[model samples]
Target: MTLTKKILLGMFLGIIVGIFLNLVTPQAYPTIETYILSPVGKIFISLIKLLVVPIVIVSIILGTAGISDPKKLGRIGTKTIVFFLTTTAIALTLAIGLATLFQPGVGNFQLEGAQFEGKEAPPIVDTLLNIVPTNPFEAMTEGNMLQVIFFSILVGFAISQLQGRVKLVVDFLDQANDILMFLVGVIMKLAPYGAFALIAVAIGGQGIDAILAMAKYFGIVLLALFAHLVITYGSAVAMFGKTNPITFIKNFSPALAVAFSTSSSSATLPVSMDVAQKKLNIPKSISGFVQPLGATINMDGTAIMQGVATIFIAQVYAVDLSMGDLLTVVLTATLASIGTAGVPGVGLIMLSMVLTSIGLPVEAIGLILGVDRLLDMTRTAVNITGDATCALMIAKGEERHAESYSEAIAES
Candidate 1:
C-alpha cells in the first residue's frame, strides 16, 4: 500500500482499538497504555524529534545560501511574515464568530470548584529579545528553534557573501541535507505504527463522555477548521499559486497525516519540508525558509481553538463578551501565537493568556481540557497546511518576479 493508505488504515484500526479499550475493557487500559501504546508512540515521536533541530539548521542554511541575493531573501521574509500574521488573525476571527453564532456553551455546565493551573506566558519583550541567541550551541541543545533559525540564516548569509572562501562549508551542508532527508524517509516507514499507538492512547484515555459533553464546542472548532482549510487556504493556493486545490491537498496528505498523528508542527517539520520540495514542487530555498519560520509563528489552528474556547467559556460562566471584548480576543490570541511560540502545551497556555487578558477565570480551562487532545491533532494538521500554503504561494510569486526582472533587463 502507499504510505497514505497505510496511515489511514492505521488510524482506522487505532479508533477501533481505542473505543474497545474505552468501553469494553477499561481496566486493561492502564496496563496496555503503560506498556504498549505509550512506549511505541513516544519512541516514534522521539525519533522524529531527534531529527528536527538538525533538519531546521541544515535546511535553513541551505535555503538561505541558495538565495544569493540578500534583497530577495528579505522580500521573501516580508511576504512570509505578512501571510502568517494575516491568516492567523483571520483564523481567530472565524473561530470567535462561529462560537458566538453557535453558542456552544449555552447549556448547563459545572464551573464551580474546577481547577486548572495555567503556565504564565512570558512578556512580549522577552520573547522578542530571546530570538537572538547568545549561545548557538545552547540554543540547539535546548531546541530553541527561533534562535537556531536566526543563527543558521546568519551563517547562510555569510556563506553567500564569501562563496569562494566557504565552498567547503556549503558543500558539506548540502550533503548533510541529503543525508538528513534520507533519514526522514526511513523514519516515516514507521509512521503507521506510530500513528496507531498515539491515537489509541488519546482516545482510550479520554473516553467518549468528554467528547459528548463538549460536542457543540468540538463541532464548532472542526467547522471553523474545515472552512479555513477549504476557503482560506484553498483560495490562496488556487489564486496565488495557480494550482488546483485538490491536487495540492492530495499531494500534501502524507505530511498532513504525520502532523495529525504527532500533533507537533516542529516534530513533523522534516516530513512537511520533504513533501513541499518533492511533492508540491516548492523550491528548497523557500520551503526551508518559510516552513521553519511558520512552524514557530503561524499557528492558525491553535488560534482558532483559543477563539472558540474563549467564547464557549464566557457563555458557560454566564458572562457576556461585548464587541470590544471580542476584538480584544482577536488581538490577544493573534499576538499570543507568536509570543507563546515553542512553549509546551502552547495552545492551552495561549488560551490562558487570552482569558487573563479579558479577566476570565483560568480554571475554567479544565472544562474543555478533556477533549483538547483530539482537537489538538486536527489543529496541528491545519497549522502545517497553512505553512505549506504560504511556502507555495511565496515560491510562485518569486518565480513571477524573477521572470519580470529578466524581461526588464532584456528590454534595457
Candidate 2:
C-alpha cells in the first residue's frame, strides 16, 4: 500500500479499537493504554522529536545558504510572517462569526461546577525578545524554535557571505541535510503504527459523552476549520503557487495524517518538510525556513478553537459580547499565537488569555475541554496546511524573482 493508504488504514483501525475500548471494555482501557497504546505512541513521538532539532538547524542553514542574499531573505521572512499572521487572523474571525451565527452556547450547559485553570501566557514583548538566544546550544537542547531559527539563519547568512572561505562548512551542512532527510524517510516507515497507537489512545481516553454534549459547538468548529482550509488555503495555493488545490492536498495527505495523529505541528515537522520538498517541490531553503517558523508562530487551527471557544463560553455564561469584544478576540488570539508559540497545550492557554481579555470566567474553558483533543487533531492538520501553503507560495515567488533577475542580466 502507498504510505497515505497505510496511514489511513491505521487511523481507521485505531478509531474502531478506540471506540470498542471506550464503549465495550472500559475496564480494560487502563491496561491496554498503558501497555499497548501509550508505549507505541510515545516511542513514535520520541523518535520524531529526536530528529526535529537537528533537522531544523541543518535545513534552515542549507536553505538560507542557498538564498545567499540578505535582502531576499528579509523579503521572504516578511512575506512568510505576513502570510501566517493574516491567515491566523482570518481563521479566528471565521470561527467567531460561525459560532455567533450558530449560537453553539445557547443550549443548556452546566457551568456551575465546571473548573479549569489555564497556564499563563508570557508577555508578547518577552516572547519577541526571547527569539534571540543567549546560548544557541541551550536553545537547541530545549528545542526553542524561534531561537534556533534565529541562530540558524545567522549561520546561513555568515556562510553566504564567506562562500569561498566556508566551502567546507557549507558542503558539510549540505551532506548533513541529505543524511537527516534519509533518516526522515526511515522514520516515516513507522508512521502507520505510530498513528494507530496515538489515535487509539486519544479516542479511548476521550469518552463519547463529551463529544455528544458539545455537538453543536464541535460541529461549528469543524465547519470553520473546513472552510478555512478549503477557502483560505485552497485559494492561496491555487492563485499564488499556481498549483492545483487537489494535487497539493493529495501530495500533502501523509503529513496531514501524521499531524492529525500527533496533534502537534512541531512533532510533525520532519514529515511536513519532507512532503513539501519531495512531493510539492519546495526548495529546502524555503521549506526549512517557512515551515519551522510557521510551526512555532502560525497557529490558524488554535486560533479557530480560541475564537469558537470564546464565543461558546460567552453564550453558555449568558455573557453578551459586544462588537468591540469580538474584535478584541480576533486581535488577542492573533497576537497570542506568537506569544504562546511552542508552549504545550497552547490552544487552551491562548483561549484563556482571550477569555481573560474580555472578562469571561476562565473556568468556563472546562465546557469544551473534553472534546478539545478530537478537535485538536483536526485543527493541527489545518495548522500545517497553512504552513505548507505559505512555503509553497514563498518558494514560487523566489523562483520567479531569480528567473527575472537572470533574464535582466542576460539582456544587459
Candidate 3:
C-alpha cells in the first residue's frame, strides 16, 4: 500500500481503538498508554524533532542563498507576510461568523468555579526586539525559532553576497541539508505506527464522555476548521496557485496526516517541506523559505479556535459581545499571534490576551480545556495547510514573474 493509504489506515484504526479504549476498556487505558502508546509516539515525534532545527537552518540558508537578490528577497518576505495576515484575518472572520450563526454557546454551561492559570503574553515591543538573536548558538540550543530564523537568514544573506569567497560554506550547507532530508525520508517509514499510537492516546486519554459534554462547542470548532480548509485553502490553491484543489490536498496528505497526529507544526516541518517539494512540485527554495517561516507565525487554525472560543465563552457567561467587542477579539488575536511566537502553550496565552481585550473572565478558559486537545489536533492540520497554500501561490507567482522577465529580455 502507498504511504498515504497506510497512514490513513493508521488514523482510522487509531480513532477506533481510541474510542474503544475510552468507552469500552477504560481500566486498561493507563497500562496501554504508559507501556505502548507513549513510547511509540514519543519515538516517532522525537525522530521528527531531531531534524527540525537543523533542517530549518540549512534549508532557509539555501533558500536565501538561491534568491541572492536583495530586492527579490524583500519582495518574497513582503508577500509572505501579507498572505499570512490576510488568511489569518479571514480565518477569524469565518470562525466568529459560524459561531454566531450556529449559536453553539446557547446551551446550559457551568460558569462558576472555573479556574485556569493562563500564561501572560509579552509586550509587543519586547517580542519584536527579541527576534534578533544576540547569540546564534544559544538560540539554536534553546530552539528559539524566531531568533534562529533571523540568524539563519543573515548567514544565508551573507553567504549570497560574499559569493565565491564563501563557496565552501555554501557547499557545506548544501550537503548538510541533503543529509537531513535523507534522515527525514528514513524517519517517515515509522509514520504509520506513530500516527496510530498518537491518535489512540489522544482520544483515549480525553475519553468520550468529555467530548460529548461540550458537543456543540466541539462540533462548531470542527465545522469551522472544515469550512476554512475547503473554502479558504481550496480557493487559494485553485485560483492563485493554478492547481486543482483536490490534487493539492491529495499531494499534501502525507504531511497533513502527520500534522494531525503530532499537533506540532514545528515537528511536522521536515515532512511538510519534503511533501511540498516532491509531492506538490514546489521548488525547494520556496518550500524551504515559506514553510519554516509559516510554521512560526501563520496561525489561522489557532485563530479559528480562539475566535470560536471567545464567542463561546461570552455566551456561557450570558454577556453579549458588542460589535466593538467582536472587532477587539479579531485585532487582539491577529496581532497577538506575532507577539506570542515561540511561547509555550501559545494558543491558550493568546486566548487569554483576547479575553482580556474584551473584558471576559480569563478563568473561563478552563471550561473548554477538556476538549481543546482534540481541537488542537484538528486545528494543527488546518494550520499547516495554510502554509502549503501560501507556498504554492508564491511558487506560482515567482514562476510567472520569471517568465515575464525572460520575455522582456528576449524582446529587448
Candidate 4:
C-alpha cells in the first residue's frame, strides 16, 4: 500500500483500538497511554515541530526572494490576507446559519457548573505591533510566528534587492530548503505509527460519556465543519484554483489525515508544503509564502467553531440573540482569527473572545470543553485544507499571469 493508505489504515486502526481501550481496558488505558501512546505521539509531533521554525523562515525567505519584485510581493500579500479574511467570514456565516436552523443548544444545560477560566486575549494593535520582532533570534527561539514572518520577509526583501551580490546567500537558502524538505520526507515515514498512537490517546482519553452527553453539540460542530470543508474549500479549488475539487482532496488527503491526527497547523506545515509542490503542482515560492502565512492567520475552522459555539451557548442560556448579535459574532470571530494567531490554546482563547464580544459568559466555554478535542481534530483538518486551498488559488493566478505575459510578448 501507498504511504497515504498506510497512514489512513493506522488512523482507522487507532479508532478501533481507541474505542476498545476506552470500553474494555479502561483500567490499563492510563498506563498504556502514559508510556506507549503519549511517547510515540509526542515524538511524532516533536519531530514535525523540530522542522517548523526553520522551514517557515527558510521557505518564506526563498518564496519572497523568488518573487523578486516588491510589487508582486505586496500583491501576493494582499491576496493572501484578503482570501483568509473573506473565507473566515464565510465560515462564520455558514456556522451561524446552521446553528440557528438546527437549534442544537435548545436543551437543558447547567450554567452554574460551567468551570472554565479563559485566558485574556491581547489587543489587536499589540498583535500587529509585535509582528515586527524586537529580536529576530529571540522570535525564532521562542517559535514566535508573527515576528519570524516579519523578519524573514524583511530578509527576503533585502536579499531580493542585492540579488547579484547576495547570490551566495540565496544559494545557501536553496540548499537549506532542500535539506529541510528531505528531513520532512524522512520524518513522514514515522507518520502511521505516530498517527495511530496520537489518535488513540485522543479517543481513549475522551470518554464515551462526554461524547454522548454532548452529542447534539458535537454533531452540530461536525456538521458546520463539514459544510465549510465541502462548500468553501471545494468551491475555492474548483473555481479559483481551476482544478477538480476531488483531485485536490485526493492529492491532499495525506496532509489532511496528518492534520486530523496532530491537530496543529504549524506541525503539518512540512507535509502540506511537500504535498503542494509535488502533488498539487504549486510552485515552491507560492507554497512557502502563502501557506506559512495561512497557517498563522487563515483560521476558517476555528472561526466556524467559535460561531457555532457562541450561538449554541446563547441559546442554551435562553438569551435570544438579535440580528445584531449574530452579526457581532461573525465580525468578532473573523477578526479574532488574525488577532489571536500564535496565542497558546488559541482555539479556546478565540472562542472566549467571541463570547465576551457579545456579552456571553466566558466560563460558558466549559460546557463544550468536553467534546472540543475530537472536534479539534476535525476542525484542524479543515484549517489546513483552507491554507492549502488558498495557496492553490494564488499559485494558479500566478501561473495564468505568467502565461498571459508570455502570450502578450509573443504578439508584440
Q: Which candidate leads in TM-score?
A: 1
User: Candidate 1: global Cα-lDDT?
Assistant: 0.94
Off by over 4 Å in 2: 410-412
- Please give the distance, in angstroms, between residue 40's alpha carbon in candidate 1 and its true position after superposition: 0.5
Predicted structure 3: lDDT: 0.93
What is the C-alpha local distance difference test score of each model?
A: 0.94, 0.93, 0.93, 0.92
lDDT of 1 by residue, 1-412 (tens): 9999998889889989999999999999999999999999999999999999999999999899899999999999999988998999999999998999999999988878568999999887799899999999999999988899999999989888898898999889989999999999999999999999999999999999989988999999999999999999999999999899999999999999999999999999999999999999999999999999999999999999999999999999889999889899999888888888878888999999999989999999999988999999999999999999999999999999999999999999
Which scores greater on lDDT, model 2 or model 4? 2
- Steric collisions counted per model: 0, 1, 0, 0
- lDDT by residue for model 3 over 1-412, one digit each (tens)? 9988898899899999999999999999999999999999999999999999999999998998888899889999999999999888999999999999988888878777678998889988899999998899999999999999999899889988999999999889889988998999899999999999999999999988889989999999999999999999999999999999998998999999999999999999999999999999998888889999999999999999999999999888888999999999999899987889889899999999999999999999999998999899999999999999999999999999999999999999
Q: How well is each residue in 1-412 modelled by candidate 4, as lDDT tens digits?
A: 8889989999999889899999999999999999999999999999999999999999999998899988889988999999999999999999999899999899888778898999998898889988998899999999999999989999988998999999999999999999999999999999999999988998899989889988988998899899888888899899989999999999999999899999999999999999989999998899999999989988888888898899899999888999998888888888889898999999999999888888998988999988899999999899999999999999899888889989999999
What's the C-alpha lDDT at position 228 in model 3? Answer: 95
Give me the candidate number with maximum lDDT: 1
Cα lDDT of model 2 by residue, 278-353, tens digit: 9999988899889998999999998999999999999998999999999999999999999988787889999999
The lowest-lDDT stretch of 10 consecutive residues in candidate 1 is 107-116
